[model samples]
Target: MARLREEAERVQAALGAAEVQLERLGQARETVTEVLAEPDAATTGQARPR
Candidate 1:
């Protein structure tokens, strides 16, 4: 019974870590989507040199 409980605890910890990783990946996807949706100045031929 103790071994079973330990296994469950380990699985729970792994799940928690996976959830955090998933959230970060979701946020990164959103940022990339937003950037892709925007028009690029260079592509529009309106780019100015710094």
Candidate 2:
């Protein structure tokens, strides 16, 4: 019974980590989307000497 409980805990931990990773990826996608939607003049590279 103890071993089963330990396994269940490990599975739960794995699932939690996966969910966090998914959330981070989602946020990254939204950030990229926002950047892509903006004008070139509004971007970080707008002031480059080139």
Candidate 3:
């Protein structure tokens, strides 16, 4: 039982880490999309200053 509990805890920790990473990736994608949506960003390769 204790061993199972430990494994569960480890898996939970890893899941939490993955969730955080996913969130970060999502935010990055949003930023990139927004940048690309800007006028002539693709041609000039410049993003507007935040």
Candidate 4:
């Protein structure tokens, strides 16, 4: 019984860590998507040619 409880606790801790990592990855993906969706100065014809 004690061993089972310890195993469950360990598994829960690992799951929590994995969830945090997944959330960070999701946020990073959203930031990248937003950046890519925005037009740069060149694409918007706002850049001066050298």
Whole-model lDDT values for every prediction = 0.92, 0.88, 0.91, 0.91
The stretch of ten residues in a row with the least summed lDDT in candidate 2 is: 41-50
Measured by lDDT, the strongest candidate is: 1
Error of 2 at 43 (Å): 10
Question: Per-residue lDDT for 1-50 in model 3, tens only?
Answer: 99999999999999999999999999999999986777885577886575
* RMSD in order of candidates: 3.1, 4.3, 3.3, 4.6
Residue 50 in model 2: lDDT: 42
Q: Show model 2 residue runs off by greater than 4 Å.
A: 42-50
Which residue runs of candidate 1 sit more than 4 Å off their true CA positions? 44-50
The global Cα lDDT (0 to 1) of model 4 is: 0.91
lDDT of 1 by residue, 1-50 (tens): 99999999999999999999999999999989987897898889876454
**Residue 14 CA displacement from its true place in model 3, Å:** 0.3
Top TM-score: which candidate number? 2
| Pairs clashing within candidate 1 | none
Clashes of 4: 0
TM-score of each: 0.79, 0.80, 0.79, 0.77
